[model samples]
Target: MPLALVDCDSFYASCERLFRPDLRKKPIVVLSNNDGCVIARSKEAKAMGIKMGVPWFQIKKAYLANGGHVFSSNFALYGDMSARVMNILECMFLQAYEVYSIDEAFLDLDTLDKNFNLYKFGCHVKRCY
Candidate 1:
């Protein structure tokens, strides 16, 4: 069985940006509970050298000075968003799938047509949700 490992890249950061278009191009980081450490970061944030599990206070000043945005963990919003993505995959691929993590899923492609173009299907699947 051909398995496709589908993971949401920068999931927390991406979820935070879903409703805020202004953040689309900015470096973004999501702090852990009580705002102590960094948990997630956008691609731009990663490029800016913001690392996971780092103490937020250590980087707050420099990160803010360089136009970075920080957010507290929003579990409700993240969970709801994750479910929607999973639903899309389940509906399209049926029973041959597994939710590997909150932001990653594994889909079995054996149910698909052998002649199907996996590359194009993968692109379409990504755009689905």
Candidate 2:
């Protein structure tokens, strides 16, 4: 199987920004289940020394001081973004595929001829969403 796992660098933070206009340029963190801990942090947040999996209460002060936005996992928002991204993939490939997660998918592109440029294909995928 010519499968590829295309993981986004900071998927949760990116997904959060999809709907929250104000979060685009700021540091952001997504908490884990029950909003108990930090599961994801943006590059901006990481630069501030916010470690992943830190308890929310422990980081509350730092988060606020650093202008970090904290969001509980909003599966709905992530799901919608995932769908939008996958729909873009569906348009480019010719065969069966399965959405593995909100940010990943497996597509069978066996039918594409030798002329298909995989790098350009990936770039087009990146641009689509």
**TM-scores vs. true structure, each candidate:** 0.93, 0.77
Quote the positional error of residue 15 for candidate 1 in Å.
0.3
Candidate 1 per-residue lDDT, tens place, 1-129, comes to: 778888998999999998888888799999999999999999999999999999999999999999999999999999999999899889978898999999999999898877879889778857864
RMSD of 1: 1.5
Worst 10 residues of 1 by lDDT: 120-129
In candidate 2, list every pair of residues with a backbone clash: none
Q: Scored by Cα lDDT, where does model 2 land? A: 0.81
lDDT by residue (tens digit), candidate 2, 3-118: 66656668899888878877767899999889999998889899888999899999899679868898899878778877877887777664567778778878776756779889
Count the clashes in each prediction: 0, 0
